[model samples]
Target chain A: MPVRLFLALLAMFVTGEAAGQVRAIEVLGPRPFGYFIGDVIRLQVDVVLDEPFTLQAGSLPRPRPVTYWLDLKTVAVDDRGINGGLHRYRLALDYQIFYAPLEPRELAIPGFSVTATDGAHRVEANVPAWSFLMSPLREIMPRGTGDPVYLRNDTGPMILPVRRWLSLAIASGIASVLLLGLLAYNRAWWPFSTRRKRPFVQAVRAARRAFRSGSGAEAYRAGLLCLHRAFDATAGRAVLADDLSSFLKTAPAFRPLEPEIGRFFQASRRAFFGADARGAEADLPRTVLIDLGARLAEAERGLS
Target chain B: MVDLSSLFHHSGNRWAGVPLLSVERLKSILLVNTLVVAFAAFTVSGWLAFSAWNDNRVISGLATGRDIAVGDRARPEILLARGQFLMRRGRLDEAQALVPAVRISGDRRVLAAIQYDLANARLRTALRLIEDMKIDQAIPLINLAKDGYRAALSVRPDLWDARYNLDVAMRLVRDFPEIQPSSEEPPQETPEKLWTDLPGLPKGLP
Candidate 1:
């Protein structure tokens, strides 16, 4: 029995939502916008809400005593009850006034009231007076005026409305940069290393700096070996045993620095493996090792 | 297997109006075509009889003019040749003007045939005007073209070329830019609002 009652209440709510009836009315725009003498000006009134009510002017607060120059008429009324619930119906009323042939800046439209009813109960609602300007007509202007002027009470904006949406503009720019950065990182660098990983250039630079510090000669040699291993990972071949000539021939973008690679390898071989000690050149000193590393770094840039 | 039974069930509920549709649309088209073909055959026979009658009428007139009796086919052949030459040169108007003179005077049927020919020439002239985009000038010319085709149809209802030309002329005239009366008032939103409001009204008889 309770479920049945609930279902009946739901059905009633649905039916009530589908029915559109006028209740309160509001004047949306400026009380006074603009008007010319002898010309008819149309003022707009928008119905705020409409449901379980109907409006009649006879039950208003001031019953027909006031007289105004402006003529009011219902222009359009829409009673649509789909999707929007009780707020679907909208009533548009027009207030028209003919020019008084006077150049006065201000004119008043009288207020009126309406009766609201929901069959059993009755209520009276009042609408306030609206004002309008009676201004002189402007002289004929050239085809292209420099810019259009906007009045304080005008519906249109003084400047483009989109100019105030700066946050949206900044957000769009940041999104674009993020999208491009993602594409570039994926295309150029992300596949090779993560944060914990070291790049081939960084490893090579570390070896060169260690050699310059004079104490870590063995560490510098190990660094060079590690860098060579990283380079091999990119080339898909071992580079420690391979001749520089053969490597340069395969990767021709590095062909211009073939002589530098040859010199560095020759000096390293004489210092570490050769039987005849060419004294100063024979001993792998820190300064000589640093210079050789710098030369190798330059060669790597050319290959890249 | 499921699809086969579904298809059979679907076939059972097929539209019942198919028979009426075929007979009303297809049969009418066939009937019209048969009637047009019969009329064309009749017009061909009429044309042959008219040509022979016209020859006899001219020979009789010539016998009266010369005051001597002679059966000569050379003169008629020479006139037909001249008319064909003028028509081939696009001088349809000049050629049509000569057809009446050769038809022999006081022959009512021949005079009607000549009128039909003149009408055809006027229709051709109107078509040329339309091709030039002279719409204002083409309006009168198109009417004359329709009149000429109508006259030919009155005498020879099976002339397909005349019918086709008349149809084309009518279409071209209708395609011309139409002048509309301008409203004095500026564009207002009230009428559109009224139209939009109409859709929300109750749909039943009330």
Candidate 2:
């Protein structure tokens, strides 16, 4: 099949399977998803299990019908499925919760497991966890309405020139120093240099230049080279051909860039080695590299 | 060439338009607003999450059941129900066996109540065995009855029947009066002569 057609079909199939799975449990919840004290927020866990299950009450340290607090009721499960399979089961559990007192609390709808025999094997698949909120009953209500808001300052323009120039100047100065150091350290790093010089910014700038020049292959290579040098600098060690996984580990910030990094690496291998990695050509793009850089910058900011 | 000065003047006029909004000022305002909204949202969400948590807590006095089958979780309701069904069917021994393994505190009181009934049944059994002269078996069963009554009393202290049964057992165990030598009476002289004659007493005893 043609490459584009194949990808489209694969995507369709994955999504199709994802849609059919039933949501067996729901946190019907403290409706409005919020609660106040002295309010009974009715909650029901709608469970559609393959086997008959019981909705028996569990023990609590404090009993309900408490004199000064609202009561939490006990509901028990029926044993309709003492001996049944996942397919032969049809059960839904419903519960109501009351937030009588002003105490704020968290509650877990415990994991439920169903036992099934897939013809030749018996397996248990636990439904994922479910939980809900209990806000403290607010002590005070809102007072009188407030006035309309307005911006009062006219010095907005003054702050911009100082803030923007300072940040940009600092960034440029840092990039320049790093570029000069890399150039002086490794003259033999690459045979060709196209006025692209910073370790991180150079890679991004080179790719941008290549895209502007309408050379996709050059743009792609520049993206990879940028990543390679950044990886080396960040790792403080030589990144080997086979140490990409280790490189990601050495710099965990790049973990979010996995998809982009993997794509670039695949494109580089196929372009240089003359090997055909199916779908590489269709997947590689300049925008992806740019986005990867943006993500990296954001991650770096977070780290700082 | 003909319109150069006019074009330059128009460009200068355009550049002179009211200064564009400062990106820094807009960003700061946005950041502050976002932080305020997020903090409020986080507060509300945390409150909602806690409310949901409260709903899931198991409260006491509610009838709850669990299953512990071999290694299977003994479902309290199933086990308790089975015990009740068995008791109704007159399978007292089987029913009694089911009650002890139920561990859910929510079901403990109910289980204790059932245990009280089981104790009563066992007491009846022990009484029957004693009537039949099955002394060896009756003793063990009577001891079991006492234990069941104790368990019932522990859970339901207000249960008078369990207290009465315990009282019955205490009363049934006969207490012999402590015997002492008579304080006022004189010693018998003839008994000493008899003791000497019988050759057990010393010769000077009389």
Candidate 3:
């Protein structure tokens, strides 16, 4: 019974060894010397396993303080899939060493083991420890006159550069003002209102003023004279009753007002030459004359 | 002459028929549209300029170390400046409260700087406490400062000042593994053995 048990145990060990095995473990790192306190050291470990064995990710190291003076800042694993009938994985570990040594001294990063499994069998891949030299930030005996514990100055808040935004605002503001000016010019708003040659508009204003001050024949005669003056100014010459058609032909925009303009000329002739202001007012009332003047002004704006 | 007669005919037809939108009517429409656009542009640009000027003024005041009351919707730069101002005045809690707002700014550089400054302030206070022999009170503050420094380093790995300060804090208090109830074996090296094995203690002042 004892001989049979020994043979069974040997068979079990042989099968276990054959099922899973770590093929290779290789570590790549930076130059291991001349590091200062608080410097991060990174290591790349590549592990190759047997064909059926795969890395168990849970066995990887967690980010934590590995020692009092060293912190495992980060850990990452890259699966290389399968190549050459072997399962491969690359492990990246970042460690921040906080040791402030008085002189250049060597320190060792502790080794750890990761597990690989193939269903029923398990194997361990050992990553060897790494060592590096760390140097002190300052001298043991300082030459400074002040305190020996030298701390770095705080990085102050930066003053945001406002020049770009300010310039943009200024440029847009100028564009807006210029656009306003253009709109004002187009609308004949005051400033531009007086600058534009709106003869009929001025005529309507003068005729209204005359009607406001006077009454009866005098007001009617005055309104007729203002309308005649506006027509002459618009035509750039004296415009008689006979010249109405030619004036309308030259300014086609005013062709829509042909009948009303003809009535105005007939009224003008009666008021000034015929010396019958009441009769002229009867032909075209003061309100009608003023309304015609306003419409002519609007038409004149369209011509320009 | 042909063009003029056709124009006259068109105008006559317009007056006699539907009285279609005249040239004057079209001009009036154009004028109204332009006026609306100009007015809108003027209002918007004026508002932008005014707000930019106001922000600059607030920033200048902050630079001079004045405690200006800022609204909740203040920009990230203003919040960062206020946090720094608070830190300088030893109002650490108020400074720390501004972290979420500053973080939301998405300006990584500013966030890292703020974290580093807050950590520095904490470490300085903790050192003062240690000098006064308040060991228990200083321990928590040092731990907080270490976390702040670590956070800053995570965002910006090249921040040497934060790294140095973190190292200083680390030497003040050592980290030991937490005991797990499931593990039957004791830790490989006890805290006492690890502390004594190397000159881990801070010599003189940190």
Q: Please report, as a value between 0 and 1, the fraction of native contacts recovered by candidate 3.
A: 0.24
| Model 2 iRMS | 33.1
Kindly list the per-residue Cα lDDT of model 3 for residues B102-193, writing each as its tens digit.
78878778788889999899988877776576766777787798888877877677888887777666655645555666978755534344
Q: After superposition, which runs of candidate 2 have C-alpha atoms over 4 Å from their true positions?
A: A1-304, B1-77, B87-93, B173-206
Clashing pairs in 1: A38-A99
| Superposition error at A136 for model 2 (Å) | 52
Displacement of the residue A34 alpha carbon in candidate 1, Å? 8.2
Question: Would you give me the overall lDDT of model 1?
Answer: 0.46
Model 3: what TM-score? 0.54
- Angstrom error of the Cα, residue B42, model 3: value is 12
For candidate 1, the docking band is incorrect
Worst 10 residues of 3 chain A by lDDT: A140-149
Q: Per-residue alpha-carbon lDDT of model 2 for B1-206, expressed as tens digits? A: 49799999999999898687776467656555554554555455555455433322211111232222222144444455555555545678887776656644456656666676666666666555644656556555655766666666555555555555543432222112223456555433243332222221122323
Candidate 1 vs candidate 2: which has greater lDDT?
Answer: 2
Highest-scoring model, lDDT: 3
**What ordering of candidates by lDDT runs from best to worst?**
3, 2, 1
Candidate 1's C-alpha runs over 4 A off are A1-110, A116-120, A126-222, A230-236, A241-290, A300-304, B1-206
Chain B superposition TM-score per model: 0.35, 0.43, 0.63
Candidate 2 local accuracy as lDDT? 0.48
Per TM-score, the best of the predicted structures is 3
Candidate 2, RMSD to the unseen true structure: 34.6
Error of 3 at B138 (Å): 5.0
